[model samples]
Target: MLSTPNKQFSIEVTSDSTTVAPPLLSTTTKKLFIPPWKVPETKAPMVFPTCPPSCNKEMSRFNLDGSLKDLGSYGFWVEMCGKLFLFGRRFVNWEQNVEECCKIGMTPIDLELATDVKCINSLIGDDDYRNRFSRYYWTFGLRKTEEVVSSYYWCSSGANITRNWGSGGEPNYVKNASENCVRMEFGRATNMLYLLDSNCGLVSGLSCQGPIIPKTCDSPVCPVYTCRKRDALFKTLADKATKVLIDPSKSGIWVTNDTRLFMISYPSDTKTFVESLAACCAVGLKLLSLHQEVMYSILVGAFNNASIRGEKFWTAATDQGCKKNFGFCSTNRLVRDNARWASEQPDLSTSNGTCLAVSSDGLLHDELCNTKMRYVCEGRAQIPSLLDAVERECAAEFKLTRSEVKALFNSTPDELREKCFLKCYGEGTGLFIDGNLAMDSIFAAFQRITFDDTKRLLDMYSAMDYCTNSSKGMDECDKCGSLLNCGQENSPEEFEEFVETVQLTITESPLILPPVKGVCPEYECIKKPDQVKLLATAKNFTRFIGQAVVLPFVLQLTVVCNKKFYVFATNVERTLSRNLAFCCDRGYRMATIDTKEKYDCMVQNRITTFLNLPPGTTFAVGATRLGKLDRPSWCYSDTEFDFNLAEDFVSNDTLETNYGIAISFEPPLIMKAYETSLHVVCEK
Candidate 1:
């Protein structure tokens, strides 16, 4: 517990990016000091190249002095400073060579550094093996927009070329030649590895070096990160609660509190729609049919209090077929009574979005029921009485547990109990923490944390403690003014459990492995610009291994409309607004699909959207709608729906069905949406 002193105490701690801890122990002064630590650095791993076996035919068997060489190992590879460089003599156009290297899982020659120029020259200068080329070897990743000097840049990707890598007075664009591609001329030349631009279409040798990429999902190599914290929490709860007991009348359901019931799916398994429903029925719980707001709030509050807060779970609510009347499978209640729809969701626009699920935000969404998902079965005991229980409860009980009690009274309250539990864990773990924390003296000293992690450790400890002792009555503990002396007035023991130990809610952020992109060299690097930018940003994240980008990566894509305009989808959640006032400084306005042909072209690409959300989850489109909601007209070119298009991306008919316009990946007739991902056709 805590010691009473004449003066107040404070802990001063400083730490590095990874962790924080206090160092000094001076109780008399009442000022605890902490030391700083530097994050340790580890050496980067050395990568090697494994070229395709068929590349052997491209190598020369003889040397200049008539000495024969294997020339195997993919047409002569050289290792320089840990990077494996593989040289190929496959004659092809510059762009084609780049794609070929990409297919083979490598990057085109990027002679960015002076050392690269020197090393490449040393490898190709061996007269003993150097005579393997025509007049020159292609080494391009850039194009010459003009014949002038300093006009060259790495196209396909917006990377600038390092200064002075080209040969002196070279890239001359000799004799009006289309010297858009760079090449290296072999030996007898004073300036070795001197780069010069040549015709991009000319056949020349290819050089590539980089990492491999697993493009498809479900590949073992595909980046995938799962949040195992959720499953682990449920498993631990089930293991410890084995003796806490389950009601036989309710079957497998765990009576978490006096009113609510819960049945977490087995740790090892998940179920689809039919399986989940049948499983719930067998257990007599019925997949948690939250018939009213009061019931929904009660379940969320109890779940938040009994740990495992802020995770996704399946609910009993579903439209099943985009039917206007969606009801609880086990009840006579409809969802409209206690609606909990996520932004632009419960999208009855598509039949596939039938099953309902709840996320940490407490929003219910319509998803495909057959989609395998973890679920719960909930029920309530028959308080078969002459009256409702909340009205009969004492004021003290309401104050002590207002979060749960409020729900019983049909009052919606923000999450409070879960936040209080988090505070307790923080108090249990650290003496020096952020913010102004006014807590009891006994609780302050219990901050000797030795657990590896607070997630499972706090929950496990709480379940084992079975917290029962409380010196303070429920009447005074719930008042904000009593926080300073919130705990029971009693002598502190060897260790004191946190006030909210009986109920805990430790949350873990979900991990999503990003789409994989291959590593490329800096010089003359040509590839998809968007993909290049994505890789560049991903490289900084060591934990994700260049595989994950924090959410909203799709916002960078821009569509070139009929090769005429860059279409930019504004980040409005639903229906682009014609509010140019938001971007008046940049003269940005909403785009209009007034022309049927223009809209058709954008639609042809099947650019899916996030249901026209205002949030910039993807690259923005420069478009908007104008006029009143009922009599709305397009604002493109400031005209009243006057443009004619060849084909419509989303017809006026579909707009009425959706209540707004948004591009989707699914083709004409019906709409399909990939969960959490949407396309924004931005033309800029």
Candidate 2:
């Protein structure tokens, strides 16, 4: 096993990075080239991305409300303009596939409108989705009437886009062969044409198009709820930070609002974990030591509620630098516990597991101190570790030392071009991950890309697109899983001269990328948007990037897609005593969170907060405190909220900085407006 180091270090040598060879002789030439746009990239172009984890979870045939909830996560569920399309399972009969969709509440695709057909095909065509068996899927829209080719009509609508069919005569009927079914083939990265008629019993992929919103929140049903848009997701964090940073009128370094900073941790805004103990000692707050359930939940809720996805900052929980044998660095008194392990966690097999970082999943993972993960500093500023990481990728690929990379970054366009920037860009070609355009990361990759290589990359991608569409893999290129395995790395002998050339100039000044069409890639630096254009070349690059940058796409994809996971409503505001009466009188106890999943759900709805509500603000949850002096009993059940308490119901009465209130117990339902008049929401 490769063990990660606990100290910041520089790369002595690059990985088995591939060198670019002159293209294999082909009829294809430089006549074709597309511009590389600053957008999202993917291996296969599908309408909806490959279903995310939450969408792909193994669900039951029925939800709690007794509805079909088993939408195959393997397939794609797209809802567009009052139309629902399900590109369902492979190798299933047209009849069975349509029946499955109908059982879970959907009808087979009706390609009555040319646009509808285009949209469905766009999912396949744009995403370059192809059938594995090369077999087409069944569609109900096309049917044969007489033995004539012109006899076919759109089953759903009589008048339709007649010119929509592919070049190959569709609805082709052979001698006595039943052409009752319409099927279309989708190859990855290929522009699939119109549908064809085939035998009904023939096995093929399934795609069903119907209504936009399903009547039930069930399988074959993907509920897209009201969620933060791409731009709005990270806005809250920015607004709160701005308020604290700009307002000279306030001294709230750690503002405790409904959404901003919740707890005073070791240092989330600025410092790293190296001399972290001494740093925190200079101030007041120590590394976060979660001895109590309330502290843990508040922190977890704070982390989960943030719209930013996949991002994790360091907490002061570790066994390193402990005066006592096994405690946090800042507080030698705090002891370690095994209860928080997230199912086979704290991999004690490595010494580096001594450091810890908290994630939005409400659990802690062991990490090395020098993992290049971001951490909040004293009052502000993120630790400069991750920034240093971007610098490293630039240095290694460009064959430039640290100082040279810095000079290229700080230099003007003319200055960089003088340094042979275009050649450097060519050298860094084929560095992207499947040309995935999504570019949806908080950390910008230092994409040392140039004009010539960008065009080369695009050219190669277009050529591959041609090959896949033709179903004729390029010369010496097998139709592998997605794209070609035909790169310099795959066949190094062809690029031996290229490697020798790059290595020959190693000790002296290396060649930079040359200008193409009198322009360098990103010339004029129209925008120097941070460079996560390329991935980190470090070993910990994958692991470190794993913690914060990649999770947002997948982790938050399904997070916003559960509109059917109903959140009930109310504005009933009363004291704990009166709210309890209201709930009991209505045959419902206050809501209670019985599981970690429920806690996460509550956080998703923004129903749970760290804010201190006035006397009549918060709803009385199922959490019970028999006497004023008694420890609160958590884990109470509330049928209406469909929840049970998960922990202790202890909180500050006067709203101390350390002890703000959270329902602690999961209560189902309600949205509250931040008005002076209390708008209490209870389990409905």
Q: lDDT tens digits, residues 1-684, model 2?
A: 111132111112122223243334343443222212212233222211111111111124447664445443325566765676666533345555554444444455656666765666565543123211123556654343544443454433443335545546544445424555555644333454566655555555556665454234211111122221122212211112211122211211242322123333322443445544333333322445443222355555555554434555555555553312234433222333432645566665344335666665556666665564544212211111112322343344335676665564433323322233322232222111112111111001111111113333244343433333433222111222122223222323322322222221111111111101010000011111121222212121021221324221100111222321111123433333343333333223345544557656655555423233333233334333222112233323312222233333333232211111234313433312111112222343
What residue runs in model 2 are displaced by over 4 Å at the alpha carbon? 1-66, 125-135, 159-161, 168-180, 191-193, 212-684
Best by lDDT: 1
Worst 10 residues of 2 by lDDT: 515-524
Error of 2 at 120 (Å): 2.4
Q: State, as a TM-score between 0 and 1, how close model 2 is to the true structure.
A: 0.27
- State in Å the error of residue 216, model 2: 8.8
Please provide, for model 1 over 1-684, each residue's C-alpha lDDT reduced to its tens digit, 9 standing for 90 to 100: 111121121112222122345243442322222211111134221121111122211113334543324333234455674455656533345655554454443456666656777776675564323333223455544553443444555432334554544555545544534555565655433425656665565544456655332221110111112212222212211112111112333233244543345666644557775667666655445566654434555666655754655666677666644354566554423565337778887665554446677774567877776778777776543221101222222222334354554352232223444223223323222211221122211121122121122233223222222222112223322221122222222212222333222111111111111101110000110112233234334221121222223323223222346432222333234222222222211222334455656656655653334234343233223322211123324322323342133223323432322222333333332221111122334222
Best by TM-score: 2
